[model samples]
Target chain A: MPKVTIDGHEIEVSQGTTIMQATKQLAIEVPYYCWHPGLSVAGNCRMCLVDVEGPPKPQIACYTQVTEGMVVHTQSEKAKKARKGTLEFLLSNHPLDCPVCDQAGECDLQNFYMDHGQYDSRFDEQKHKKKKAQPVGENVMLDQERCVLCSRCVRFCDEITGTGELGIVNRGSHEEITVFPGKEVNNAYSGNVVDICPVGALTDRDFRFKCRVWYLSSQDSVCPGCSQGCNIRIDSNLSRPQHGEGERVMRLKPRENLNVNDYWMCDEGRYNYNFIDRNRIQTASRVKEGVVEEILFEDAVDSLASVLGDAVREQRHGRIGVLVSTQLTNEDLFFVKKFFKTNLGMDAVESRFSFPEGSSDDFLIKADKSPNTAGAQALEVIASGTYQSGEDLIDKTIAGEFDVLISFGVDIDGLLGKEKLDAILEKVTLLAYVGSNHNETSKKAQLVIPSTVYAEKDGTFTNVHGRVQRIWPAFPPLGQARPEWQIICDLSEKTGFSVSADDAESIFSEITQTVSSFQGLSYEKLGKEGSLLSTVKETVEK
Target chain B: MEIPEELKKKWDEAVARYEEKRAALLPVLRLSQDHFGYISAEVEEAVAHYMGTTPVHIREVVTFYELFHTKPVGKNNIQFCHTLACNLNGCEPLIKQLKEKIGIKEGETSSDGKYSFSRAECLGACEMAPMMKINKDIYGPLDKDKLNEIIENL
Candidate 1:
């Protein structure tokens, strides 16, 4: 270990660490471009210039090596002047286009300019002009004028995704980035280039100019897109109404969960927040016949238990099947199984939906697509593990063994198709549903209990690889809708089991002790930065 | 290796700077630009590859900084510093005059490429408002005839 003093702070770092690393270790930030922690070091920008005692001139801390006990000062007059000059030069021809640049508030160039740039410009000359608003890829629109040309995005494509789609073409002033003739930036991780581009040179076509980033607020939560359970932040405007309800979700962005998704989310998850808009069904209620009756909290539980009890004792297995969807949280499934299996003693607990409703691209999305199947099953919830397809589960429900059936599902109807799943739901005596969307499944259910979307509820989920992770709620549940645990807890108390209030931690603890896989785990230790719990089993990327 | 005297002079100057290899860039580029007039593709590639930054990275300083010209400039780079003070005054009308006299638009050189026209931002000479730099020379409070005379001389 080598110890060094940076700006009067003494710190020890491992060998092969640069002076830049030492400053970073001490949290004494030095401005830099062309050096991303995830990418290989390219000490080009000259922005992170630092002063060392032995070395006469300011050295780039990124590439400069740190020796034992060598003094370094990043705040010297010489260093400051050098940095200021560099910034002035960098800003000379740069179009003051921050008003329109998407990276305005978060841009490093803007920040560095304010921090280290000279107040007075040096150039008395006309600015060089370049083409603007060039479409670089399917999802990205590039502005060549705004490009700093750090090549982080290009390098990310080449090295990270192994898809070398973008390159800096031409040379010097005439240089611009473009895709190879026939090749486009149409990779699974292509949207991330927009995120990595330090300037507004690259902007996502989907998110471009919809709303400035400053207006939308973000919440750290897990992605409910797939069983991968990549942690994410839900950016929304709470004051704005949903369908004029005064609160709505605008977009989904990847939160930094290093273990799951390190600041990158698949395009599917990023753009999938559209359905949660006001037009979508968020409130819970059951529709009987042609008349829709919205029942109170206690009544919903009693009605469901009574309905399932009637089906289980007097009726048969196929008639009174329980279809639990993958989008459901562990708490919902826990109480779901408790209400049916413990109280009614029903055997049907299988997922209502599986993965890949569309084409399966070989990337983050998996074929077995439910977000929380493993968690539901880990609780001894009666789930048909082998019966993978949503249509298959619906087919078994329509086989006529039982009369009344219930489903806890969302986004499942599309996979089974409307007519196919509806034909199966039509055979049942009573179809009760707890879902976020009022699609075919919920419509078929004689009683519908409006469920909260993943963003609106706080719950724990078991991803595909059996890693139990907790998801924090970004927004409050929609009006009259409730978390699955609360709904099921109400049902459990009415039906039979000793049920607690809607406290996820208590339920998780109860599950953890009994379930051998999750022996000594607690929500407190499930990695705010991610630690490998023994029971996590295997790391699933997709 | 036989290095040009001018190149060696640049090298010596870059070495004289406190930070040798790092400071070598600006001087080297300026010398190369003097020899080559414009920083051509081959020169940019060699400089970037030698400097360990990509051509794209080096291009930022070359284009953004007023001094470095990625393209060939005329014998004289006619500049009107468009800083706060200059823009406040009637630089627009003055630009119109210069444009007409030069017989080429701002940012364009003559057909022979003897004179290039460009409007620069603040050159840190606020007191000398409406100042312009022709290569390394400074001219301020410029008018139509002064601009024409300067262009004609160039």
Candidate 2:
């Protein structure tokens, strides 16, 4: 270990650790632009220049390794002057349009300028102008005039995704970042560039001009887009009701979790948040003679409970069937087993239902499109060796084997063709749907009980890796909708079945007690970064 | 356009001279520029292919150096030195006179495709102050009459 002194604080670090990494241990703020922990160091930005005791001039801390007994100063007079000069040169060509820039509130250039820069303008020459508002990819927009030539976006494309669609063309003051003549940055992880960009140079095309970032409130959550449960922060527009589509969620930003996404998330998960507010089933509804009528959620729950109670009491449990989805959390799935399988003795409960096939890559995207298939597998809801696919569940319903059928966020039309799904709906006497979105299955159900999306609930989703991560609620369940776990608990209460759990935490506590893979875990144990089920089992054995 | 196998063989030899493949970029670019007069976008793409790098990286190096031309520069390439030494020795008016005589601005080629003019950095001939390099030759201590005569001879 090499010992280095930074700003009067002595710390020992590994052999190859840089001054910037050492300063991070001492809680010293060394402003940087091009130095991303996830990407390779280019050392182009001079913002992290620090004054060393021996060196004649300030050295760039990003690539300068700390030698043994080296003394460094990040806030010395020389260091501050060097950073001011670097900032002045960086801002020489940057346009003064922060009022209209989408990244104004969260941009590093704006933040660093407030922290380190207050210098008067000495430049009398006209600023160099370049292209602005160029759509670089399917999801990213480019404003060349605002760029500081950091090459972080370029490095992100070249190193992280290994898709080198971006490059710095020209030289010196005339240099600009752009793509090839006809190519676009349409990679699977193209949206990550906007997050890594330190200035207003790159912006999200979907979120640009939607709402000011200052007005958006962020809550910690996990992306339910795919089985690779990327940690995310849900940014919602609670202040502005009249924003686009009346959507509460403004955007989804990837949170840094080294075990999972590592400060980068796929474009599919980053933009999959529109469904949180679009086409949502806000209130419970009942269909009669092909006419839909809005009814109270309690009435729908009571009616479902009575039918389930009748089937269990009359020894007709074989007539009751439940089709579940992997979109439901682990707690929700656990409650489904306790109520329908354990209490009602329904043998036909299946959660092997499939979602639409999504495109995937080796990096972050998973072909299994749902978030919690492993959760269902861990709970044995999709029991091993049965291999009963979602199609088999639909086939049983179509054959009139079950008089009552309930779906939990399973879009039957998406799984089967519309005509085949309609045939199944006609065969079942009481078709009930409990989901947030309005799909073909929700539309034709005799009784529809609304459920909350992953954003509007607090639960744990066991990702494909068997890692149970937590998701905190970003908003209250929209309108009269409730989380699926709470809905299941209500149905259990009305059907003369006693459930020991009331909320998501209690349901998860019950799961930890029952499931072998989750024996020694709790909500506090599975913090932001989740614990793998295999590791949890090992800990319990120890 | 595809790069020739002969040129690619030279590039392979150049890459073997350096420990890292990226260090051979300048030598490889020089080989392409020697075989093909100037580096077009297609030539840049082909060179990047031969170098096993991206075009933007090659483009950055190509545009940074004064020797590598991106476009064709006719029969006579005139490089007017415009550094501090040449400017202090009154080279600005002479550069203006030379551009006027050639019927072109800086970085512009002649309409007849016979001449090219570009303002260059210090050409290392400050002793012969107020100098301009034409093709393979350097002319210096230039006045209005001397610059016009050089252009006339070209």
Per-prediction interface RMSD? 6.4, 1.6
State the lDDT of candidate 1 residue by residue for A408-436, as single tens digits: 76434666567766666667777777777
Please report the candidate that would top TM-score against the real structure.
2
Stretches of candidate 1 exceeding 4 Å from the true structure: A180-183, A240-247, A293-299, A309-319, A352-363, A383-393, A410-412, A530-533, A536-542, B1-154
Residue A310 in model 2: shift from native, Å? 1.2
TM-score of each: 0.73, 0.95
Residue lDDT tens for model 2, A1-542: 99999989999999999998999889899999999999999999999999999979999999999899999998899999999999999999999899999999998888988988988888899989899999998899999999998999999988888778898887789999998776788998999999989999999999999998888999999899999899999999988877775789998999998878889899888988878989999999999788999999999999999988888789988877788898999988988887887887767778976566789878788889899998998897852233386678678778887788888888888788798778887788898999999998898889999999999888999887778899999988898999888898889889877874657898888888888889888999998888889534323210
lDDT of 1 at B137: 84
Summed backbone clashes in each candidate are 26, 0
* Clashing pairs for predicted structure model 2, backbone only: none
How high a TM-score does candidate 1 get? 0.73
User: What is the DockQ of the complex in model 1?
Assistant: 0.04
What is the C-alpha DockQ of each candidate? 0.04, 0.60
iRMS, model 1 (angstroms): 6.4
Model 2, which residues run further than 4 Å from truth? A354-356, A383-387, A535-542, B143-146
